[model samples]
Target: MVKTSKTVGRCEEFTANDVEVLGKAPLYQGFFSMVKYRFRHRLFAGGWSEPVDREMFERGHAAAMLPYDPVRDCVVMIEQFRVGAYAAGCAPWQLEIVAGIIEPEEVSEEVVRREAVEEAGLEVGELHKITRYLSSSGGCSETLDVFVGIADSRKADGIHGLPEEGEDIRVRGLSREQAYQWVESGKIENAASIIALQWLQLNYRKLQEAAQDLPLP
Candidate 1:
């Protein structure tokens, strides 16, 4: 077993720089093609290195919002079908937080708010930045910016989605207790939703107290 160390010095002679792909091996062919690519890279730490030609898949950033209504003590989530899961021989449909890819000209918060409206048909107010991290760092370059959004989650009417985009999202509202139960019951399966809900559970009291101190809108 490799022992973990926090204070390990950087290796000068043996350095691993960013890996780059030169070509790809075809994996799947559908609406979107999935491929594994060949790569060439360079390593530089104490000294400079030459550029190595490589190939990689084009990827985008995504955003997810955990809609929470402080007054109502409820949360809103969306359900959708994930193609990647189906390809991996798992459940294709998944319950997830409101999320979308970040457009080239759009900001992260804007992406989250737009996704909330598109996926759930809800207008969000102030947004609390939760965390930003890579979703699957192994093969994908997609990163996720997650936020806890303030909204009237209790007022969610029903499922809402954009037909033009082939989206058939189902919007659902759940009380804090219900959300927690779903997490425990294995109903909430998506990573972002699970992480956001768990974070909310841990910080619920502090957030509630903070919300109480805010002025009425």
Candidate 2:
């Protein structure tokens, strides 16, 4: 295989197409449909290679919120069960940043705010876009857009979720120090939550100082 990060591939005569399965093999009969998706192409100045077969999947995007209360020096996160992790031999339940899938025709920030309200029951104030990146590039094509949302963490309580969606999310708040300890102890296992907490830990002091400058609330 040729290795290059550039758009141009070394094999000039190469042409590829989406794989289509015409039949299923017996080995994977009961479990999965053994369908081969063939990508037919030729190498530059070389004979045609056998078509490459691979499974295809869709790409998805998610918006996550890190609810931060500068005055209280705390952050909010949610705990929920994840089917993907269970299937991957990991703990089925996980503590994660408030996140939701970006619906069709929906804006990223809107998704973040909606998720925060639904999962944590907090009205978002200032929203700071953190960063966007692929969650798992090797197998999954899922991109995550993360944000830091300012909110009142002290009053955060109650079980918040859309009953119609069968969501049983537990909303919880943690002090900056406690959150950092969780990160160090490997307790905040979720990637998005950990990243967001770390970011806040690095900037929490500055945020607290700024909050002090404001008039008494």
Candidate 3:
């Protein structure tokens, strides 16, 4: 008897044709768009299943950066009123990493840099990619690109954010160790913040060695 490997490992196995979009109608259209979709997808066991109708909330793609100061061993965080938290009976004002939505034709680095200044008043230099994930696939269509940007947290203090945009953000710098404590204590509830801090905890030495070769900004 001969042992053979039968693992299917090609993207061609799954394509847009695999899922049939029967119809889609706009349920709401404002700053964001929501749509009702009637579709059918091929099952992993075999062929297509019955048509399923569901509503999807679309907010497009967004990018978020967690600004860090490897030299200072610190991180810059911001606090702002979050409607989602308020609606969920959590604190409206929650601590989070500096982040913003990527505009049309804008790249990940550009969005995070802009957001860093707007949210934390800190200028981010080099960026290390962390992770990209969907905030919630079941309902919202929000894809987030998370990064850890190198910055000088020594002077990252005071309030920031554009008043016209209804943003009132408070910038606060925390030691790397303290930031991790916040994560362990549930003080840092945002996914982007928690992930970035833990990543820094594990990769701080790598960042430090890389920083030594570059000119300080």
Give the lDDT of residue 93 in candidate 1: 85
Count steric clashes of candidate 3: 0
Q: Any idea what lDDT model 1 has?
A: 0.76
Segments of candidate 1 deviating more than 4 angstroms: 1-57, 215-217
What is candidate 1's CA lDDT for residue 120?
Answer: 90
Q: TM-score, each model?
A: 0.76, 0.73, 0.91
Order the numbered candidates by TM-score, best leading. 3, 1, 2
Cα lDDT tens digits, model 3, 1-217, are: 2122244444326556567788999999998899999988866776668999999999988888888788888888999999989998887999999888878999988999899988888878899999999888998889899898889888788989999999999998988889899999998888778888888889999998999987545
> How should the candidates be ordered by lDDT, best one leading?
3, 1, 2
lDDT (tens digit, per residue) of candidate 1 on 1-217: 2122233346534323334445667666654456666654443443224444333344678899899888878988877898877897767888788888888899989998888888898888878888988877766677898888888875676768889889998888889789889889987677888889988998878777888876322
lDDT of 3 at 126: 90
Q: Which ten residues in a row have the lowest lDDT in candidate 1?
A: 1-10
The global C-alpha lDDT for each of the candidates, from Candidate 1 onward, is 0.76, 0.74, 0.85
True-vs-predicted CA distance for residue 47, candidate 1, Å: 13
- Model 3 Cα displacement at 48 (Å)? 1.9
- Which pairs of residues collide in model 1? 21-39, 21-54, 21-55, 22-38, 22-55, 23-38
The root-mean-square deviation over C-alpha atoms between each candidate and the true structure, in angstroms, is 6.3, 6.3, 5.2
